[model samples]
Target: MSNTFSSPLAGRSTGDRLILGLAILLSLVMLLPVLWVIAMSLKDNAALMANPNSVFFPPYELTNYLNIFATSSVFRWIANSLIVSVSMTVGVLVLSSLAGYGFARLNFPGRDVLFVIVLFGLAVPEQAVVVARHQIFSLLKWHNTYQGLILPGLSSAFGVFLMTQFFRAIPKELDEAALLDNASRFRIFWKVLLPLTLPAQATLGIFTFLNAWNDYFWPLISATRKEMYTLTVGMASTQTNFAQSEGLGYLMAQAVFAGAPILIVYLFFQKYIVTAVSGAAQR
Candidate 1:
């Protein structure tokens, strides 16, 4: 009986160990690309080209990072990215939240129909409208301008939808109570509802910021001048330059520079994003 019991216990322990090992294996697989990029960023062009397999094992060089910042307009690109992203985030938060609240709470004629039409905007691919958007920008004389880059992404249909859902989740009794206290609808929104929906707002802000920051194709198409280039566009330029020179380290360093800001932002807002996403999922 003791032998029989020991045999079953040992089998179960082995199965648990196997599952754990597989999970760790999967995690390492997912991490490989990021590790490879970091390794490549530290390698010199000669070392990278001569012994590509050995690049992963340190004896690292700092020249790639030093050379990239010294020679490239990386800082300018980062500044442009920050300006556009912050402007876009602020605009989306204010406009989308107001629009969402209006659709959720304030009654007006044809509101539902109008909102349904707005929902269709979310379904439309942005690429499909790029040509028309370019034409409009040209007509308005806004091309290669910060206003041109920032204005187009200021209002997002998905943001409106997200905020509307969160706003609707608030109890109607709270609104009524505020009104009984002689509060205006705007006051109620600012003082009461906004505080309760901080998580959702944070989630929306991060999403909007990330979209604007990492936007490549639109900014590339719209901002024809090098001075107007965002990080994504700048990185593309760096890739072209490095490809001509065959400088793999410099290319990887530029990629790291482009990706770092986004990583930092995500780290800061990750908790709020997870909370808001989980709440939405449950709802």
Candidate 2:
């Protein structure tokens, strides 16, 4: 008689099963707050006030989400956010790619010193630089402009660092081979090395986009004009007086609405993100 396990998990030891079960339990526990928020978003504001626990009961509706769309400026805010985030992400990638290549492959006077200066930027808090940046932009009369919003975010030290590491990790033989084929430095970077760094680029781009999109404090101070407000700032501006008590559902709805686009983005690119993270871990 021959016996073999058909189910892969059938081979798992008791401890493995217990660990898997605990992982599932933890995942559900983590999801509880998100589930709560989604539930609150579906309940009527009045009903919620009367009975907060009604979210767990019946009579859910899409009124809160609809109300968000009903607001005239919501679409404008969304557009503004997209523009800033996309622009910043592109700028960061381009600048970082070039800077990374220079740092990784090229030799120049004071290269190490300049790289050290960039690393120093990683330690400097945004709050520390905000006053100076605001003052300079104010002097340039750049406030409430797209340039004001996008330009400041482009100097991404972390993006440069990540790209540099990715470039350095790539085998030098590829660069040498490209050079042997009469390829210039720029050509090698554009056609050879850049393609190999797709994982790192995806990782950097996703983080940069998310950071730019979710940024509120910077936009709040720089984009004082309502027309220039990003989604985060604009959403905050839309809140009516006493929103917590008077419009709990609507408030929760806004949270969901603001977060929904990023969630959708993550769902689409989760595989790439996972791949990037794994590659980084292995490196």
Candidate 3:
């Protein structure tokens, strides 16, 4: 008994140690840019220009953060970002879940063909449809509105695919059981199926939010009004607000601010995200 149990208490193998070392090394390597940006944000203009690569040798100028809020509309940009990102995420989840479940279960005549069309959309780049989307939005007078920001991104091929595949993975017995209980289709979907899909939903929500949050080109074109500007667009425009001397620190400070939300989100949903991805791939 002692001999058998001793192996369980043994130290990790050398390969495990090596792998752990590599992972830490890789993490540090990835972390360098973030650390550098933080360092830059804490620096003054003269120090930043004098030794751009000589990072961390500092009496850190913590006022860069305060200066940013005083000099620019960072809070407003954050609000706009949250509005667009949250709206788009919710829209994608609701629309995609319904559409995906329909595709997986409904017996409509052109269902497969339509699903194929949505799949084909994955192959099409955003730049390809930018002109058409622009013209249509222009005609609809959606430009510079939240509708302009949120509507175009609501229909996501990846979202539909992820949800459809996730729905299909659920046992048919659950649906049949719900049917025998006299529950309606939407009731089954909302109560029974959706709960099981929380992981996938989290994954899809993260993806959509990050994409919408980081989106710049479409907003740049459609958001003619300053008030409509998302964080990505607003942050880019800040480059011109600062003099060349102060540009580095100013940009770094704003970059950190802009990146904070996504980091918090990722950290929160990381486990669900990993599970969702692995499950989707298996399906």
Report, for every candidate in turn, its global Cα lDDT versus the true structure. Answer: 0.87, 0.93, 0.87
Please write out the lDDT profile of model 1 over residues 46-124, one tens digit for every residue: 8877887868677898888998788557788889999999999999999988998998888999999999998999999
Name model 3 segments beyond 4 Å from true: 1-10, 241-246, 281-283
Error of 3 at 86 (Å): 0.5
Number of the predicted model whose lDDT against the real structure is largest = 2
lDDT of 2 by residue, 130-182 (tens): 99999999999999999999999999999999999999999999999999999
What are the models' TM-scores?
0.89, 0.95, 0.91
Looking at model 3, residue 282 earns an lDDT score of 78
- List CA RMSD, all candidates: 5.4, 2.3, 3.3
lDDT by residue (tens digit), candidate 3, 138-185? 999999999999998998999999899889889999999999999999
Please identify which of the two predictions, 2 or 3, would achieve the higher lDDT against the true structure: 2
Which wins on TM-score, candidate 1 or candidate 3? 3
Off by over 4 Å in 2: 1-8
